[model samples]
Target: MTVQLRHLFALATCALLLGGCASNPPATARYDFGPLPAPSTSSQIGTLIVADITGPTALDTEHMQYRLLYADARQARPYAYNQWAATPFQLLGQRLRANFAQAGVKVLSTTDAITSPTVLRMEVNEFTQSFDTAKSSQGILNVRASLFRNHRLLDQRTFQRSVAAPTPDAAGGAQALAEASDALAADLLAWLASVPQP
Candidate 1:
């Protein structure tokens, strides 16, 4: 073959190989919940108001950058292969409401009737996910919460736990986050149930 023809043939082969690599599917992540534990029983159905989680505050500075995955400056990251999801504040609020409902607590919106004497307000201080090098790109989720009623402090707690992604890929990281969120919700419910009603 002439030099120019040989060069063209080599270029075509490289293009095909690169295209195949680009189209390859990301690895799948697995999530497992061991059991569905019963919700805590409450004798009185109290009005629990879940305010929209407030923050992206200075408290969040520590974790703000952690959620972003490393990427090349020129190449934008792929959302389909990225672990980005609802903000932590939104996720925590949703999970909290679900847990309260499962525990037989009556959740009230801000405008709901105030027949119930007590109100529960929560402030989230920390919600972060980061890669753990020891576990080969596995990630960890950490959350902190505080509770109040009628502008007086009721309770405060911090929750931190690590979850392992199925692989080093983004899908695996997302799965790990879901697992962590579920576990946190369950724990939060249990804690709330244990608290004595005023």
Candidate 2:
């Protein structure tokens, strides 16, 4: 074949190979929260209802999120093949309820006929794996919490925590996030206990 024809044939082969690789779906990995600190049955501070936590629509799914602080700090991205076993809100709510029980708080469901005297509502503002630089990353968790009694607002506060990842990959991020989540839950329960009951 002529030299020009040979070059064209080589380019076509490369494109075909690359296209095939690109077409293959990447492997997906799922993650979830670690075992919670066990439930508490001894203390009954008061019956409290934990309303479903709300957050940005983007976080309403099971996708794993990360922020590129070194590039555009405001931009959040999801891993193409990595996802949470459950959505962040669901996981957070589950952990928080478990923590409250462990703390001797009587947690109840809103639909129960005998309603709790107090209600805890929360909204998650930030939940992601943030990278300060290419070599470092951490799981960040921020939440806005509100307390209510007899349908009246009592207090509101925001909590934020960050835990460093053991590695810069999804597994590391998952571990860091679980730690941060547990920490946040503990803080919330402490804050609730400090609030005076009417």
lDDT, candidates in the order shown: 0.57, 0.87
lDDT of 1 by residue, 120-179 (tens): 555654343454453354445555666666667678787765677786655565566556
At residue 157, candidate 1 shows an lDDT of 81
The residue pairs found clashing in candidate 1 are none
Segments in model 1 whose C-alpha atoms lie over 4 Å from true places: 1-45, 57-85, 111-128
* Candidate 1 local Cα displacement, residue 104, angstroms: 2.2
Error of 2 at 111 (Å): 2.5
In the range 1-198, model 2's lDDT, one tens digit per residue, is: 999999999999999999999999988999988897554334446778899999999999998999989899988899989999999999988888887777777787676665677888999999999999877999999999999888899999999999999999888999999989888977777787789976
- Which residue pairs does candidate 2 place in steric collision? none
Query: TM-score for all predictions?
Result: 0.59, 0.84
